[model samples]
Target: MAVYTHVPAEVLDALLTRYAVGTLVSAKGIAEGVENSNYLVETTKGRFILTLYEKRVAAADLPFFMALLDHLSAAGCPVPRAIPARDGTQIQTVAGRPACLIEFLSGVSPTTPTAAQAGAAGAALARMHLALADFTGARPNSLGIAGWHQLAANCGDALDRIAPGLGGRVADELAWLDAHWPAALPQSVIHADLFPDNVLMLGDAVTGVIDFYFACTEVRAWDLAVAHAAWCFDPGGTRFDPALSAAMIGGYEAALPLSDAERAALPALARGACLRFLLTRAWDWLNTPADALVTRKDPLAFLNRLDAYAGGGLL
Candidate 1:
């Protein structure tokens, strides 16, 4: 989703030679996300995304990510399918990194998604969870509660560098989350990261969902909690709009009704979701090089959300 490694023309061509995706016309670096090296490559066959796994995206986990996409596509999710090479391999080595070619999905990510779009995003997510219920694989959520401490420790006191009391507040919040996080709530293969940019919209409908690198086995309703944090928060991350939150949850409930326990546990789960992003963003903000070809999302935005959630600004 970001461009840390540049793909030289010959490197790309040599890889494409093994596939029938045709001659590479152009490969433009996608400059949106902070995870991996992504390019919008146009070829004689069609357009596709070439992702070179970068930091944090382990080479061992590549099979899980690829297989999940294949599974979701087979189950009729509106996600791009992995394109295998002529020799029947789905992944290839490129730029000395694990690489794969995925069909380019149509539509654009909405900059300011509407309420209807939020609803559709929820519905689409519900459908995906239902379809993935049969998947037998298990991948631990590296960003789940068990992983938060290391991330905060990785940030160390640098979190306080972002703000005077940010480190102490993050520590306190993580401890509370570790103790009170929900235990049982209809678990399934949940899309742990469903931020707006990861969804492609054609009008109010979701044409595709990308970036399954963060997907893992977790509480089913936790997906909705992640969506609420992503879609309902304001740009400044200063406020959480109840109307937007309601529409999103309402949309999900339409497909799968929330249990009484799930309903009672949602606010805390949402607060946890916000903390996951807040810490990760804060870590990336401090570590990534400024001249890198990617946008480092503002960790302060989530800091504001942490304050909002702590102060009962989010319902």
Candidate 2:
């Protein structure tokens, strides 16, 4: 059974009443993410995902995330479309947390995604990026440099236990990033976390993407690098899938070709992406409160990725 932050039936009923959707038949937690509390809500009309924004997501940024989905969906992107409330608001306060209902995308995340499937994911992501090219809204990078620093500070005490020298490594990486980070890359809305878990597929075809909580405005190449980290690395981290990376890049380049500078910086950007996930996973492992209903992701999985990038050379 999955851990669920219980929502009383009465409150759920009231929430449903505020929407055009029918009465809720049942609700259960969707146990895949570490950030927000998600529930699979079945209504007489259809199934939907009820997301209760957690601490990591700022309330102010909810509009951008929601609007981005709407924009993307309008432009034929395979992302969940927000179900507007009777009051026409895309988001609402529920149980003291900002909450909203989204049309549940039908598909499962491929556990062992093939190169073709990865290529499809890359294509879908590129389409999403192009669709939102004209979007002018601004949202902070939730998992960018600033958040990395804060996470390290919060989990400073646990570094020795989780991973030795992680603290110093984080400091050094931060310094290196501050000095060498691209200042004039092509900026756009990026789905900062494009991991396999966030992508859904039906058979070999890509279906939809979820977990836009980390979406923000940033370098497009950084987004590509993050996708590479997720698609290229196996769980054990000993294996490398060059074909998968190539397929993904091929699909993306088909939609939006990378600039020479973007390609040049991809190696370092991939390294930075690796470290970002490593630090967050470590912090979550150590600092997730005992009573919190969240699973701690493996920090070593990302550490292994960092190691691979070090030797594999990001060409």
- Write down the TM-score of every candidate: 0.97, 0.94
Error of 1 at 283 (Å): 1.0
Worst 10 residues of 2 by lDDT: 1-10
RMSD of each: 1.2, 1.8
Per-residue C-alpha lDDT of model 2 across residues 1-315, encoded as one tens digit per residue? 123366777888999999999999998876675788788889999999888887777888888888888888888888997799888988987787888888888898987779898889888888888887888777867678787788778887677687787778777777877777785889898998999889999987888887888888898889989999888878755677888889889988888888999988887788789888988888768767787666678887877877677664655
Q: Estimate, for each residue in 132-249, the C-alpha lDDT of model 1 and write its tens digit.
A: 9899877888888878888999899889898888989889999898888997778887888999998999999899999988888898888888888888888779766777787888
- Segments in model 1 whose C-alpha atoms lie over 4 Å from true places: none
How does residue 281 of candidate 1 score in lDDT? Answer: 92
Name the candidate that leads on lDDT. Answer: 1
Instruction: Please tell me which predicted candidate would have the highest TM-score against the true structure.
Output: 1
Cα RMSD for candidate 2?
1.8
For residue 298, model 2's alpha carbon misses the true position, in angstroms, by: 0.7
Residue-pair clashes per prediction, in order, are: 0, 0
lDDT of each: 0.87, 0.82
